[model samples]
Target: MTRSVYVTGVARGDGRQVVELGVMELLTRQVDRVGVYRPLVHDTPDRMVELLRSRYRLVQDPATVYGMGYEEAAALQAEQGQEALTARLVEGYLRVARDYETVLILGSDFAGTNLPAELGVNARLANECGASVVAVIGGRDQSAESVVAEVRNAHHAYTNLGCDVIAMVANRVGQGVAAEAAGALRATLDVPVYVLPEEPTLSAPTVSQIVDTLGARVLLGDEAGLARDALDFVIGGAMLPTFLPALTPGCVVVTPGDRADLIVGAMAAHSAGAPPIAGVLLTLDEKPPPHVLALAARLAPGTPVLAVPTLTFPTATELFTLDGKLGAGTPRKAETALGVFETHVDTAELTGRLSVARSERVTPMMFEHALIERARADRRRIVLPEGTEERILRAAEVLLRRGVCDLTLLGEPDAIRKKAGDLGISLDHESVQMIDPQTSPLRERFAERYARLRAHRGVSYELAYDVVADVSYFGTLMVEQGLADGMVSGAVHSTAATIRPAFEIIKTRPGAAIVSSVFFMCLADKVLVYGDCAVNPDPDAEQLADIAVQAAGTAARFGVEPRVAMLSYSTGTSGTGADVDKVRAATGLVRERRPDLMVEGPIQYDAAVSPSVAATKLPDSEVAGRATVLVFPDLNTGNNTYKAVQRSAGAVAVGPVLQGLRKPVNDLSRGALVQDIVNTVAITAIQAQGGDGDRPDAGGDGQERTEGGAA
Candidate 1:
């Protein structure tokens, strides 16, 4: 967690690059490739050369890192050989310390001298590169606090280190004089004290840790679960060598053919997030011996095991490039291994394996209505109204032929096919059966109902059929009669013109009052639900409340967690009378009726957000600041407000995800886009899942669990 710390002075290397290497080796303990640099490197002592070569991977001898090798790859290549060898030595680093886990820079000891140039330069690098300096004081025989005085002196050399010196590590102190120096140093220094013991491997992360960090799920070896940033693993076991051809680039898995033991063991371990096993080859059909099977159950449960009947060495070359991908239907072994990992020895790796999984899917879609896999196996019937002649017939063929849905066009077959050919729609005459507007079986029933509804105007039976046939409410009648699951129209009609027949034919959602509309605003970052923006120009208090509840509930069906926010110009008691009262009254109604809902507002934009402001207003309200569903006061505010928010905020508004239709029927805009038709089909499909005509929650549940924290 503590990034690169700048270590001043070196006891073992070039006094410059060696310290950088030493620190990098140490800091890779938890952070990846932390940057290293020397703020100032004046001393080029001979002992520094060998130190750099052996430990810092120096490729040259007598090479000055601060001068000729300053920008050189090896930094000290001349002192160690192979011209290009320098490239691999200090393979990756920046002159500036950068954001290292801890930047450890080496500085020449000033020894109370007044030049201060070396000390000053190091301090400048630390400051410019934004690093915290840790003075690594090294001496041959000094055990006195004066030896420690160099640390404090050099630390004060920098005036701008935001975070102060963490601690001091006394390197190479004789055991006999340790007590005296330790006691004196702690009493004098304000920072924490650290004693660097005789451990050669100070702090570099182990290969095991790197492997583990990469989430290497090892299906082999006892130390398989060990944490490693990177480590070498034999790609293929010497069995069934030909299987190596299938290996991708990732960690290697070793197994024996016919040894169900190796197969089961590898699969189980692979299922868990151990380092990847490149490829598994079977020795033959004999696998999963008693021991391996038990381990497999414990480790790679449900992981798909490939059986290669052969030996290990043959496939080694092929497996060296194996890479693993985790996906749907793949046993989410890591997430499932959390509880088991808690008992493992690799605490660091186990903790990651034990933690909740990182979401690999998109956040819940805002409108759950129903979705037919637009490109896959899922498809449903989408009706195109009559008179929409060109677009309607075209839309239906697009839905049917492209598998967006099963198509049901509302016009007479002859007319539909003729128009389809004209518009390039491939709808076969057989595909679009004729529902003679005049002679269809339901015509008499529709005529009876239509004439009765419009009878006050003295409409006759024939006139009723003419009226019903004119707009293709005749197709909606099919939906009412259970001949079709749903209908979508409005291509040649206004929103209300398309929706009116649906209302008369299908009726209201069970127990619902006013059927309203909402649009799902999906952004690359977040999703929002805005209600009644498409319908109900000015709903009273009760209607507004219903819209809020319905929008939130509809969001729940789409896998969104509903945090209802009743929006108005004023936030929570800030404004008075009609408009504010409408929202407030709506909020009250939602709370009293749907107490399970987290509803807030009569809240202003700032307070609805700005947690600081929200804390001042409705500090105790759960949904006050985090409300995901907003119910606006009236249509003008809701529609224009959502549009403004969408346009200004770069949101993609989907829907008028029309809610409260019987079954999953919906109305489209006359000017609907191609994508709009696709989205509407998906929504209608979502609406068809449950037997209930109402749009149940996406998962078919009626309510959202507040604790799920979706949306």
Candidate 2:
């Protein structure tokens, strides 16, 4: 059966698109195939449906997504008495239901329709489609008591009309009243009530949106600046000194275009970071003189400066009516909307209520999406040592844009800024934290601490000071001191230079015998775990067993279910050699210690992942031919095999993600790309969230210290 969710609004301007986007994200995370159906769409090809299709990669046809346009539906309902309209909607929805596992039905907006009782029409359509309803109530201008009453009434209205009202959402309420309204509704309502506080960014008009709405001309600004959110509007009628102080971060300045002094002052303030304004809106259709405008460009090269025809008073009135929308161009708004929705709404509970089945197979896309979503859930701070590298700065932009994690870039601040500027990358945003490793106040303290930790290894204070000046060592110290949750390096440095600091300062977690690595080989269909391929050169029975155990744990930490295959040339008792003996011993040790693990050994590569091969060789084995985790016997074999598979099969090998550290400090390849850095940073953040990787205890700590787990 195709489970459907009807996202409808009780009134106009409810900002239900945010909820719709959020629900779509949750649906994609769980189920593989999701379809969208809109009962009544705008005449000119629904923009919302297009956004959903492109973002979620939906396969549903656009023609099939909508039943009919609003005017057509209204005329049909009026002429045929609503029965014909209901039948038309049901037929369209059934076609979508037949093709997808889950269908997200977008109800009509309650504005711009001649139909009577819009709420009742939505309720009737939901009931006829056999769909559960998530009603959105706009609280933009309502009081706490009124918002609660409206939500309660909407729920009853839907339920009374024989629709399954799964949840009630109070969206866009005032900041002070949002929580109180939510509490009041939850106390009175039986269903899950989610209250979203008003996000100024989501409501703020973007420069592009304003330009489109007001028919304004852009005199000097870049595309990135046009996408900035206009959070507040300050009418510029005062002198430059008086008005400069009124400008706030993300606020748009409304002034006459002839006021050159105010425009220059506003641009200067943005450069100084004294509350960076979104843009300056020139009124009365006047533009700055040529020389003044030329000087304005030098002060803030990319800051949006627009000129609108309306005067200041009328412009302010029109600005009040402007609101943000989620479209293809506004990706940052989408991120902010998702962040806000995820923070305020109980998505797990909502998913459960919808009864969408969880997918059994974890696709590579799903794995990457899960990594990003998990990192965003509890945002951790990750520091990049190679801040001056263009790849690092570019990846930081992508990470910050996606709201993946908080980033701190370590290098000379001037050099980093200049490099980023030359690359056309914007690093002046507040999300990035830039620091000079040598000039930081923590340098002396970190040097003293390093000297103490390495005193027994024959290190003096002077030598420690020199090492502390290094970027890699300084980043590691930040992680150790809890200034950042994790660190990623080696885009331009050797792997040894990256891992040496972690090994010396961070050391191995208590109880861990050694550190190991894994590569998430993302195949076309699924993701497989390959372990100890990068770090370990050779291992005896004990270290090999530890590696397998760690590999299994690592696999499980990711979504992979660990069914480990200890690889060798032999299949069971088919061959005998020194290497085969070691594999057999490690298998026995793993079985004896962790009885719960599904592990197999003395297995050939062909028999481990191919079911047909397993049926011929070892049909009764659980781990054979369907293994998710592959453990290699030696470093030479493991490294070569993984590389061969990666190059030959065109797999995206995500790691060499180091494991079994007290804190998460991952080393990147010297040839790492921008996306590689992003992926490694996400993995490091997830590792940090796993809470202090397993440690080794002194004098025989019984805890297992496995490095990477393969499923």
Candidate 3:
């Protein structure tokens, strides 16, 4: 039977999308094939379905996602009566549900639809579809008592209609009152009730959304800047000095286009980091002169400069009504929504109540989810050296928002703050710790320690003092001196600059021959470990064996089973060369060192990965067809192969994760994205949990395991 969950709301302002998105996340985490079905939708494109399809990588066709538009359903219900409407909705839903293990059914939004009693309609469809219900009630601008009554009333309404009410969510409740509302509901209702406080940022409109709402022309600002949320609107009617102080963080400045003084002043204030204004909106369609516009661009590079034909009063009126939405374009909003939902909801209890069966396969999304959950379970402090980089700051916001790990960003504190403010990212939380490498009190101490550690190599105290002030060295010293648990860098710095400090200070772990690196090749269905891809040009047989062992341990630490395949140009003695001989020798050394390990020698890539090829080439070998840890013969082959698979096979390559280190110090590519930084930081925190040792099964045992193709 296909398990189904119906998320419907009692009113239009319920903010039920948050509940729906959270449930979709929970479903994807537990199951491999999850389907989405919207029983009724407006004529506009379905934003929630698009977001789910993109975020979860769903293969369901867009045409099949929605049963019919609101007009069509309303007409059908009017012409043929309620029975025909119910039959049509059920048939459409079953068409989607039949192919998936579980389906998420989105109920109708009570917006402008001619259909009568939308809530009752949703309940009827849910009952007919045999789906459990998650009822969402709007608590916005309502008292705690009022919110509680509404939740109770909604539960009764659904249950009276024969819908299995699994849970009730009071979304957009006022701050400090969610606890009260939740307490009152729990006393009266038998089902689990979650209260999600209203998030102002979620409702704040982005600059891009403002442009669309007013039909304004954007003369400046990059995509990232346009995506920033506008928290407040400052109508610029006063003098430059008076207008400057009114500018707040994420505020948009509205002024006449002829007032270059106000425009320049606002941009200058934003550049000086008084409080990062969202952007400046010029009204009356009067653009400044080209020279002044160029100067404004120089003052704030990515700050949006928009022009609208309407006067200041009309533009402000429209801006007042514009609200940001959770859609395909706004991913940061989705993260914020998830963070808010997860904070107030007891997801474990809710999932248990829904009785969702966990899937055995570990897809890429599932693996990524596990990484974050495990890291959050045992929170650790990680230092990012590239503190002022835009991507790093954005990723830092996500990390803090998700409660993934505590962060120690190494840079000038004021500079980092100014950059974060410009990007509308708040570093005010306790989880974020900023430091200036040049002026930190620990600098002298780190200099002394670094000098002592490198004195044998003829490094003087003065030189060491200068070197320790660099962010990379400063971060590595923090990890070495126990100030931080791990370090992830190389976003703006070179890989050599990032890891050289680690090699000098942290050094290699005990019994480790040399340090190596591995990339977690996240294929569509599984994860494979490719080692020595980013380190070591060439190695002898002993060094190759050590790399293989280190890579295997890394694979197991992150929940990948290690069936070692010593990759070469040949398979099972079918070919001979110097490369083949080295692989053969390394395989022998691995079996000798770890007699219990499953390993194959001099295996070709085809035989190592394909069951049919293994049957013909090495039928008797256990590791030939089921290898999870692939140790490349050299760095050249490993690096190229991982990139090939990443591009050609559309795989997600997650590392260059440095192994064989005493403490966790991972490096990133120069072109790493914001999510890449987040993933690397999580990996570093997990590694810091004392799993990077010779024991291959150190972190693997007793940990929650999910089966899949990758990580």
Task: Point to the candidate with the largest lDDT.
Answer: 3
Compose the digit string of candidate 3's lDDT tens values, residues 1-711. Answer: 999999998778788889999999888878889999998988646888888988888999788888999999999999999899999999999999889999999998898888988788999999888899999999998999999999999999999999999999999999978889988888998888999999988889999999888888999888878989999999999998888888888899999999999999988888888777889999998999999999999998888999999999988998998877998988888888988887788877888877778887778888888888788788999999889999999999888877889999988888897788667677878999999999999999999999998887899889989999999999999988888989999888877787778788887777678878999988888889999888687878999999998888889999999999999999987889899999999999999998888999899998899999999999999998889999999877888899899999998889889888778889898889888888999999999887573222222111111111111
RMSD each, Å:
22.5, 4.9, 4.6
What digit string (tens of lDDT, one per residue) describes model 2 on residues 608-676? Answer: 999999999999999998998999998888888888998899887888888777788887777777777
C-alpha displacement of 498 in model 3, angstroms?
Answer: 1.6
- TM-scores, each model vs. reference: 0.46, 0.84, 0.94
Residue 345 lDDT in candidate 2: 89
Cα lDDT tens digits, model 1, 1-711, are 323454554233212222233333333322322333432234444233334334332333233234222324223334544333323322222432233333334444443322324444445444444445555555325655655665455445443434345545555444455556666767876764433322111122223333433333333333222221112343444343444343332233445544553455444334432323323334333455557656654553322233433345544443444322111211111111211111111223321322222232222231211242322244445555662356555445444533445556666655554444333233443435446665567778888877875576698988887877754577776666666666777666667666666665565666566677788777544567888787787888998898888898888886568988888888766679788988888889998989999888788766665678888888998877676788878777787877788779777676776676666667676666655675676676656655336432222112211111001
Give the range where candidate 2 is weakest over 10 consecutive residues by summed lDDT.
695-704
Q: Residue 588 error for model 2, in Å? A: 6.6
Which candidate leads the pack in TM-score?
Answer: 3
lDDT of each: 0.51, 0.84, 0.87
